[model samples]
Every structure is written in structure tokens, then in C-alpha cells.
Target: MSSSLAPGHPQVVVCKWSAELVRSMLDITPHVFVVLDEFDTAYMNPDWELLSRAERVYRISDFDSNEEISAVAADLILRRASIDHIVSFTEFSQFGAGYLEVLLGLTKDPMRHVAFRDKRLMKDRVRLAGVPTANWITLADPSREDDVAAVRETLSFPIVVKPVAGSGAIGTVKVETPDDLLPTLRGIEPDPHLKSDQLTAEEFIPGREYHVDALWSGDTPLYLIVSAYYRPRMSVLDTEPGADADATPPDGSYVVNAEDAPALYSRVTDLHRKVNRALGITGGATHLEVFERPDGELVFSEIATRMAGAWIGAVISECLGYEIHEAIARGVVTGKIPEVRPSRPYLGGLHLRPKGPGRITAIPDEEEMLAVDGVLRAQRLRSAGDSVDHAHPSEWCAFVVLGADTREEYEALARRVCDELRIEVEPAG
Candidate 1:
């Protein structure tokens, strides 16, 4: 058993729904203060032996309500210990984390949390700062014709409509024609928890998409890495049938090649610095997405005030020699940002999603995937007879990490591994 909290140890409060990427944070600190949604307590029960090690835990029945979370956190702080920092890596927990930070007098500007969680607000902040971004409009009433006409006039075809505060590409739709606009809008089911006006319609910039992950101190970037997506996330999210039915599942490959794209790299880093200042991210990790147009123009997509999800941290830790969890912990604990950068030539990773909807009957052997050249790790997310949903990115079943000496070599290995891998599923009855 881990010993009791030692004096002078930073007492970090973590607000989370589950413990996916949270173990490292727990392991690295001696005094942990956990805040969990009451519903997640069941799923987290097995880890109670470990969670009990924390100095304290507060479970709120309504995690979405900032008032409830703040009240519970306030009572916890007053009754038990003084919290040095409030942190959350998950999207859903950001609201509560931010609320707690302000309620406990940790950060003076609470809008940073709002900007980080709300995509609509995030883009507006960047645009206000003179950063180039896709033209966008918020539609409180999807049924309003004036709003639809506004989108047609202000943006080009193939516009993107998504929840104002969504992640993992959930509820995101790409409409290519004005004819499909209203129908697509009607088809979207707004999250009941959000306001009626929380849907955003934005111009979809067609180009190669890339993400910049970095650790920051005020407006200064201590470390950053640029990675390219093998397939745009919308390719996986579009469920309109026809060609999409025959579409291949995403192998989830994102390549980090700073050496080959130094010019674009410089541009993205500069834009990221501007974004951080605009978003008021004084210190912590940030994930920003940008579109490299055909003519080489870079347009801002959106930014998150947390580490990149989708096992990005794992790839970075494996290839760059800096674990994201540790960086976040260190930043939160001591406010000291690590001075580190990508030390590798090229690093790539693949997340395997189900090719179609059905019950998974067979999957490629994990050992075989691991045996592939340049492959570092492989794991199956589902077993035989497990159901697979092909609609959302969250339903993807397997993940593999890789490293290589060059971008071309890494891309080839990633393609071969994805091609050879098989996930067999039987049609639903």
C-alpha cells in the first residue's frame, strides 16, 4: 500500500468521469484529491482500493451542473485539505475543473475554461485575435431558414455542423450541398443538456489536417510537435450510406514529421502561440488542429486546453521521451514547464476502428501486429462476439504504436500493417 500523504506534497484535485489516462497522475503524486461523477462510481468501484489512496474523493450526482460541482468541491476543500491545483484531462470534466479552480480562488479568469470547452467560443476567441479561421455562425434554431440562408451565403459547400461543445467528432456532420443542409440539420439530435442555440455551422476547409500538441508557460511554448492525420476525422463520421458503406475503416494513423515540413512547422507553432494568448492559457498542455490548404495556407480549426486524446500522449511519450501525464503533473504541481522537444525523426501511430457494424467474430492476433516491423505495441479493444458500432470514432476497437527513421518508411509500414490486419464481424440478426 502507498504510504499516507507527506507534508509539503502538492495536493492536486482531479475531476474525472473515468480513469482512462488518470492512473499516471495518481501514481506520480502522493496527495490526490479526486472528484467523480456519481454514476461513474460503479465503473470505478474496482479501482477503489487504489482510489482510496487519495487524500479524499467527492462524487457529484450531476456532474454537468457547474453549480453542483462547485458546491461539492467547495465543501470538500473546506472540510478536508487545501487544494493547490485543479486539473482534468477529459472534455466532460473541464467545466467542473474550471469551476472548482475559480471557486477555490486558483485562477482569476474563469473564461479560459469556457473557451477550452466550447468550440464556438474557442473559434471566436482566435478570430478576435486576428488569427485566420473558417467562417462560422451559431444556429440556435436549426429550423430557421434565415440561418440556413446565412450559411449558404457566408460559407462554401460542404459546411460542417456540430455541437458547440462536442468532442470525439460526435454529432458532427458535413453537408456538401445546400439541398442537404436543412435535412442534415433536422437529422441532428441536439444534446438535451445543452441550450437550443448550441449548434454551430462553419465552413469546412478542405485540405490536409494536422494537430499541434505542446506544453506551454504563459504565451511561451516550451515544447511542440506537429502530426498529420492519415484520414480526416469526418471521413469516419459521415454515415450517409452509399460510398461510405463501402468506405474502408480508418487505420487511425497520424505521423509526426517536423524535419520534412520545417516551414509549415514554424507557421503552425507561431499560430499556436497566438491561440494560447487569445485563449488565455497561461500554463498547461494544448492541442490545436489546423488545415493546410492546397496553396499552403494554414487555417485554425479549434484548440483544446488539455492533452490530445486518442492515445496521442502514448505516441508522444514513446517517440519524444516526455510522458504527457508527467508534464501535466509537473506543470500543475510546481508550475515548471519542461524544456523538451521532439527528439525522433518520425513517429506514427494507428488506431483501428471496425470496418462495419456487426458482432466482432474474429480479430487479427495481437502478437502478429506487434511482430510487424516498426510496430512498438498492439492491443485488441474488443473480443469475439463483442458488438461493434461503425458510426462514431469512440467505437474504434484497437490501437497500435509505431516508430521509424523516416516519414516515407513510417507511412509505408503503417499502410501495410493496416492493410494486413483484419477484423471479422457477423451481421446482426
Candidate 2:
């Protein structure tokens, strides 16, 4: 009999929810049954339902309260079941970890999986263990303007303001001056539903950024892939000429959500490994963002205890010939080490930005762009007549993936891909 698919069905939730993740898990367990506990963020609607029909199915909904969520998690344990493994990959998984312990019947220490939502606390503990980190402070009272002022005085200009306990860069802002502080505060004010832990402010380090995709095997590091950040398309930045002058600077905080470059990836691999050990993060799949200063020092921006978002999973696989998400899922399920060998020496990927702002009126040269040598795949996220904001990566319109034999070959293909593809957005006015 297949595992149950209902909420709190312990055995059914072992498989990952996303298409890419599911495909990877199937490589290990072809007939896997996945109990999707929370469907809102992890999986979309009709697609999820269709997949559930063929595979072992179970569904779960958000509980009315935190207590309910905890209760449901606990009850699943009392009903003894043979769940080969228990796994969680979402932010809410932190809350479920304790409950999963009782349900999984595992003897590992659960407390070691400390809740890492708090930037101040997470960095503090890591730093005390001799990890290199940026100077940061938490403002318990974001309502008090003076506290914001105090942070500015201490961190100086170009400081990053964000919720101390948060992810996705929702209320994150880079304040460049005393005048910019109030405007930045006003911007995040609408996020009133934000948690108190979402109130940390820190100094902004000017450096080139990179991401390390790794796994932890019994406190030993197993790096699956390392990404070189050649370009960063923060949502707050302008997509074109006039958009920059009109919109407020640092309006959005999602880093690498919109666009990235594939050229700088190799140089970053060693740098990330060094910092990962220093930070005392020796397990699980971590998406570590780092900043390489002009002076050659690598500084940390932040690290998420999950995979890098925004098609990065696919990007990593295409560029480096490694399946990172698959490694993470396998490790979570059986506590087994993943075997990953990069198949190619050189590759590249690129996301096209709107040459200018407006509605996406047309993509002029599709076949010509696709015909470019080394271009492996192209996906256009926006369709004709789709309205696009100048501020987000989704609004950027399209992406291209390529495999190459040399760094020069990969870079040349990327430039040609960007140059040949054309995007036209209708002006908002």
C-alpha cells in the first residue's frame, strides 16, 4: 500500500513539492508518495492536483493558529506509522521540526536545528563561534524613528535596513543618507503584518556577490555547486532609463530574483567554502550569498537554510552540471550522502531585461536568438500583452541557458543571446 496523502500523513510528505524537486526525488524513489502539507507557497494548483492523482496523494491546509499547527504535527506522531523518512524545506518547516521529531521516531537532537529566522540571533551565535560577519544591530522598536537614526549613525550611510527575522528581502532597503531613512521606513510600513523579528538593520558591504549551494554530511561539507554572481538584478533597481529617475531607489529588496550572470561562477567556489567553515554551518543544503569587496575581501550578505529561489535550481544544474535540489532531498530523507559529479567544464545562463518599460508588446527575434550556437534552452516568462512592472525580475521577460567547452565560448554566447533578443514594453503613461 502507498503512503497516505492527507495532512499530518507522516510518510506521504517525504517527496519534494516542486516540479524540479519531484523529478529529482523520482530518480531515487520512482513511486514516491508526497503529502503536500502547505500548498500556497510551495506548489501551484491544477498542476499539483494532477500530479497527486497519479502518485500517492495527501493534502494539508494551514492551521487556524500556531497552536493548531503544532497540535496537528504532534498528532501525526501518536498514530505510529512507517514513514521511511521525514523532510521539510520551507520556512514553516522550522515550526514543524520539533513535531516531526516525535513523528519520525528519530534519535537525533532536534534542538540543534535552531530557528534561524532571526538575523541578529543567527549571526550572533555564528559570530561567537569565530565566523566572519558584518556588524549588525536589531531595532526592537522600528516604530521609533530615533532608533532608525541611531542605526544610521552607527552603520553609516549605505546601510541595509531589513526585518531582523525575515526572508525574501520583503522589507529590505539600502538607505544611502539621513534623508533616505524616512522614505525607506514609509515604504515597509504597509507590511504591518510583519513579525517583530523582522526588524534588523545592518551596514551595507560593497562587494561582488556569489552563492554557494552545499550539503552537510555529519558536520562535513559536501558542496554540490558554486555560483558566480556576475550580475545582480535587485527588484528595486531600474529596468531602463527613465524608470530610474521616477521610482524611489532601493524600492525592492529581492536580490538575484530578477537577473544574474553566468560568467563569474568558477572564481567564487573556493571563496564560499572558506566562509562556510568559518560560519560553523556544516550541514544541509545552504544558499549562501557572499560579497567580494574591491579590496579582495569576501564578506557575507546572508544565507538561507534552503535552495536559492527564482529558477536558480535549474540555473545551477544547467551551468555546473549538478543537481543540487536532488542532493538536498535525498539527504533529508535517508541522511545519506549525495553523489554529484559536474558533467561539463563550462556553461552559461542569462535573463533578458526589458530594454525599456511598458507592456510587453513583442519579442522580435526568437528563431534568430535560438539559432545562436551553444544556446540550449530559452523560456519567456512574459507573453505579448502582459503588463510588466519595471521593478521585478518576472517583468524582465525571458531567459536563455547554454553549455560550452570554454569560458570564452560561454561568455560570447551569453552576450550574443542578450544582444539578439529584443523586448518592447509599452509605457505606463
What value does the lDDT take at residue 247 in candidate 2?
A: 32
lDDT for model 2 comes to 0.55
Residues 1-429, candidate 1: write the lDDT tens digits.
Answer: 333457677777877744533565676676777788865776656377677777777777755787788676667555656677677777777777887777777777878788887888899999999899998988766777887788878877878998888887777888999889988888887655454346788988988888788877666666677888766777754432212233332546465566677887789888987888788787777888899888888899988877887757778776557666777777656666456565446776777655579898887768977888777767777888889867556665777788777767776776676677767788887
lDDT by residue (tens digit), candidate 2, 1-429: 333444432243442356656655655554444545565436555256446543454455542234544554454545434555444555545444434544365535444344344577666765665555678877777768788777777776777777765555555667788788777776664334343544777777776556666566545555445555554433334344212332311211111211243334444545445544544445566777777778867666666666665546556555434566676666755567445444445654565656556777876444555677776656667778877665333334666666666666665655555556667777866
Error of 1 at 26 (Å): 5.7
**lDDT of model 1 at residue 387?**
90
Worst 10 residues of 1 by lDDT: 240-249
**Off by more than 4 A, model 1:** 1-8, 17-29, 44-46, 80-82, 191-197, 237-249, 335-344
Question: For each candidate, what TM-score against the reference?
Answer: 0.87, 0.74
